[model samples]
Target: MHVRTWADRINNLREINTLRNQIFVGFTLTMILVLVFAGAFIYGEVSVLLKQSAEKHIQQTAIQANGRLDVLLKQIDSLTTQVVTDSYVQKLLLKEAKGMPSNFNERQSLLQIANNYMAYSSGISSLELYTLDNRRLFPLDDSSIKRISMNALTQADEKKGRIAWVGIDPRVSDSVLAIRRINLLDNSYLPGGYLVVHVYREYFNMYESETEKEEKNPFRSRELMLLSDSEGNPIISDLDDEAAKSVLAQTGSTVTLEQESMLAVRQQSKVADWKLVLLMPVEAATEGISVLRTAIFVSIGIAALAFLLLTLPLSTMITRPIQQLMRSMRRARFGGLRVIPDGRNYFRTLEINELNNTYNQMVTHMNELIQVVYEKEITQSRTELKALQAQINPHFLFNTLEAFYWSLEEKEESELAQTILAMSGLFRYVIGSAADNDERVTIRDELEHAQRYLQIMKMRLIDRLHWFIEADEQLLQVPIPKLIIQPLVENAILHGVESRISPGSVTIRVFSAKPGFATIAVIDDGVGMDGEALNKLMQSIEGVPSQEPKKGAGVAMSNVQRRLKLYYPNTNERGSGLQIDSKAGAGTTVSFDITIPPEGDGLS
Candidate 1:
């Protein structure tokens, strides 16, 4: 009745305690199935043995009764032979009675001969002779199938065979009759007339009657039925007529009717074409079996109950602690990064409590270590700020000497003085910013630094160097990683224009690339790298594979790359801050992006 698909069963199993329930289900099912099969097998075997024993009893009794019936019929057949041999009866039958009004003396003589056997044999109903020629009234006693009707005599003439058992004769009181026709053949072997012997029903029912036996027989105490096929009619029974017919219609040797729970068994007559059926109530037959069944079921139920009771505590011990641990873990996952506050109270087992305690200590130590690390970073930052400040004064002194030289008049020398003045301005700008740890600078500050450095470079390669700065004026004040662009310019002049035969131009462009982002690109028309060399240089900038050693062509690209990544941090695909595009004999352009926050704010 609990119909579910395999998929549904599997899903339900997934949502349950798999290990404990699997064992319990497997054990319980195995026990139930084994017990059911065992009980069914015993019941079936016992029923079969009891039924076979009962059927054997019925069969033996039916055989004896059938033998008696056959013997009685044979004796009646023998009497017909006696009557035919008698000289008086032969003359009476062979002589035609068709035209004669009556042959009183001849008929009387025939009856007298048959009366000898009739008197002794209680089964015989009557003996009579009839010629084939006529349907006339004779002094014949009444019985089944119209023995006295001329139409009946003519009808009996159609039966060319002999020795038939007839049941339920209308002419008698529920009596059975046997008709035997003796052929009175003349010399030509034709029927002159025939004799009939009607056997009494009492003879067959004699053994079946209650008065016949002293001891009670289980198979026969109840109604015993007998039916013999005659002519074309079915076997006849005297029990509950409807129930009897229904049992007769049953195909199996035994049938148990549900209404009355009666068990009916059918048997075949060995000596006659009859079926013997015995009817007994089911309760009477299986009264003791019901008690046995109850005891067996109780025993099985008790054993199963005991098994389930024992498993309850065992399953709880295994699953409860695990459930508690998962509950704590779930709270930590969804609630907060919280540890078990009281390990001993939370867990019943010692080892589990110890494990919880260990995890709690680990969390505590990790938090303490984080605080120590934060303090150390502040100390290191302050020390680096002091060291950086120390380097700035010397750089300023060199710039002051240039201001003194600005008084000279060789236009070129004055240009050199302007470059030194620009360099000094760069030094002051970098040093006097918000704080040492604040690496974020405005786009305007970065470009100014790059401009000063380019001015200084123009003095070195005055005629050979050409440069330009293009920018979106609105993006000039956007916050960017400090000193990010200035280094790219230095690298371009050093490895690019410095080595090229032709004069090279360095172009710096700062623009608003999109909403909330700014781009700075430095392009140089110089000797670009070959395939292998470019690959090595790109690897260093990207911090993937092994970096090229920081000497020779390494330059300031690596430092620019590291700082840009620290600020922009390509956490999503919208992407890397630094881009290097170059080809051999063409040119190199390095570009990077920076956050363009609101005017009052800077990069976080």
Candidate 2:
């Protein structure tokens, strides 16, 4: 039997391993294929987009280079025209044509004029003047004399007339080579001596300084070059000479050439009949994109690793419970009344355990509901009995008082009329038409009721009784619970003054405490209570004992305590604002500090 169990266990293990292997293999293949296809698609699209972007970048560079070249050419043309028409140059040309002798003093004056012009013109290398007659050349410097001839000047002035500008000469070594002639007028007559201005190439170089200072990405490799009129001939570059030459030859509408893994942009400038080329390498342009791609691949790898680690455990947890339930249901043959031992040990899910607990709790609550119904019925019967007892005792006492009043009247006892009248008033107040159902009365009404009760008791112990009532007029109108003050006064009369043999006195005082509370205190000069009796009185007042006999002073006192608790359960510490202060053989005071409920809080 043990051998058979081992074989079955081995078979189960093999089956589980086979199932796990198939699931893992299928999931890994699907994820890998999906990731590969997505990566390929993204790479292809990004490559095409990057290429188009590079082309656009080159086109924009070309446009900007062309605009800058045009601005420089216009500025140069304006400067040349201003120099040739300068007043000083016109005066010098006029002086030379007047047949003035070629003396040192005359040459000195012309040289001074040329120096003044050079000061104002930033790129003027040399200034020269040639005459139609070969008498002399003024300010005859070495550079000016090297390439000067009388016929050459006359021919230049004839071919390109007044205000005409000649093209840049190859023989001139300056960056910018241009010459312009000004025809001198002798009192509105044209002269033969021409005013010539030679502007140097360094003027264009000054503009290059402004370009270098403009902000550009420092990481990008850039090249700026000047091309000769032979459109493909490269002259000078800010980068490698060989690279500049190669870049110039490839210039077209737009072109990008790959150098290893880097891309270059070739842009041309056609202003001044010269090409300006700019080359940028690609590695700098796509550095951010490469970093973004690397981050995406790293994130994918982390997610794949986490998924692999969590799969087997998550799958087992999900399937284990269903497998157990299926096995149990099969063994029981799907019978309803079979005892399926609580499966808390067999199940690992908290939700399933909680569901079972809730079902058990529902059954328990149903049983408790039935028990609550019986307790409520018992409580109802007790309430009815208490109500009946309250009614019988009050009615019997009122009837006895009425009979005694009639006997006194028959005997013609006129002196007892005030006492009898007081008795009648007391009975009327206690058994009055049930209070307005609001359970509250003004302090004036409550005090009046207490006075009538004292008057009736005064008649029974004539001449031995004394009482005083003092209350603030403002507190008299404040609302308090109906019989809240009366009970304490009754207790003072029955327990303090009545229990003594010597002549006793009772005093009732009412006063306003704060804005929302009133105080009614009953004090007696009769023998006060001992500690034991006081303890019993306090316990009875607190309703500590529910048994019949132990409820001190019978229904009236107990009912008052109950009503106070029911009405204001949260009143002060001793309950209902009722407080007792006494010492044996000393007077006792029972005070009711009643809170005046708000005007609209069911208190009329």
Candidate 3:
């Protein structure tokens, strides 16, 4: 019944979609199963223990009863021996065997002695004496004298005066008997007479009385004892005839009698060829087991109730936050950007609280984003207008420079015209590349732009600086960043040559460093820096702050280094980025490498 209820509950639980209900149902079923199995195991072990204890008790009782019976049989044997060996009885038996008549006084005295023996003994009813021809001798009255079986007589004769146990006296009611043969002490040693001792059935019933007295409680087990003869027929039994026979036929330690389970034990009597069987019902032996079962099930029931009570609230506590979060999200989806109420002060799990906080933060960010996007749109429109207005500035500057160049050529000032033309081309290149937002240009175009920059520089510095350009024609078509080389030249002229008192020479070298790489170097023999200044410059170019900030060359070098890194972000070649080497009053070299892409692959 309990199993069916639990199965039904589990099936119902499966229909519940809520997380709280699922957790509660799952935990409750697990606890119930554990308690049920534990209770069953304990009940089984205790039942076996009770049965084993009953078996031991029954076996002990059987052994004790069998011992008592042996002691009684031994007393009966001794009584028979004493009677057969009596001097008076012996002489009388001899006289009777000789067909001699015995006096009345002698017979009376013998009867008195026999009566005394029976009167003083326990459980002994009467003693019978018979001659060899089956004539009664000692008992003058024949009314109560029970006739013994011929088989008993034969068994006694074979014993040679030893007592032989016969289970019950056949001609007597409720009496058990033993027989012995008297042998004549003469050269012709032969049977003189036979002696039979009768004992009341109370001899067996006395043990049963004692057993009942010891266990006075009528509700306790009632152990039945049966004494069976050598032929397996019941001689004395506490059970009825049929029940005794049925019990005797059973071989196992437990039996079922009268629809009740019984524990059976058997013992053999030493002084008689008899078996004693003891039967005790199992229900009476383990009477307290019912109470134990009740207590266990009740305790399990109470525990399950307590667990259910606890589980409901615990599952609610766990899922309550998530449910609230869901409701909050539903509101936000329909109601526009709105922050969820803060729950940090409430007693809740960390992860759920974190989720709530994250949702609130997202809502706040969305509200702020609305204002930011509005302002950004207005600013973008204004910036676009300004950009449209500024587009003609570069073209205007180039055309004016072009007109100046033509005027100088018409005046035959060819060097001045060439310089103006170089200036105009340089401006166009810078402005065009920036507007396109594409930094890549062929090595040839980059070198030409750098030469134009150097031409303008020479016009300003004159003899203070001399510059030369070296190149490998095959490598001129390799692509590089547009202003990469020009920055290095600017740094050389500004930081190296401007500070020198004597004329300084600057060399630009562009050639293949290896099969797939090109090196562009700007070398200048100017007033080079010492170790401290060089270290400061190096740190500055790598975007590290120095205690003393240097501008001009430092700013140009830093920009060029950043551009080279962005252009070739994954290049692993040793001299792939801007490298600087300088010594005090010797020279400074600024160089970088370009990786040539494969024939058909796009440049990263």
Q: Give the runs in model 2 whose Cα sits over 4 Å from its true position.
A: 1-141, 145-352, 367-438, 498-501, 527-586, 598-602
**What TM-score do all the candidates reach, one by one?**
0.43, 0.43, 0.54
TM-score of 1: 0.43
Compared with the true structure, the alpha-carbon lDDT of candidate 2 equals 0.62
Q: Name model 1 segments beyond 4 Å from true.
A: 1-128, 133-165, 171-174, 180-195, 200-259, 264-278, 284-289, 304-544, 547-604
Model 1, 509-585: lDDT tens digits are 98765787777889999888788887888777666655436454444677777777777777235576567788888
Q: Write the per-residue lDDT of candidate 2 for residues 467-524, one digit (tens) a residue.
A: 8899988677777678766777777777777778888888989886666666677899
- Measure candidate 2: CA RMSD: 15.2
CA RMSD of each candidate after superposition? 13.4, 15.2, 12.6
Error of 3 at 573 (Å): 28
Higher-scoring candidate on lDDT, 1 or 2: 1
Better of 1 and 2 by TM-score: 1
Ranking of candidates on TM-score, top first: 3, 1, 2
lDDT of 3 at 2: 100
Choose the strongest candidate by TM-score. 3
* Ten contiguous residues minimizing lDDT sum, candidate 2: 161-170
Q: Over all chains combined, what TM-score does candidate 2 have?
A: 0.43
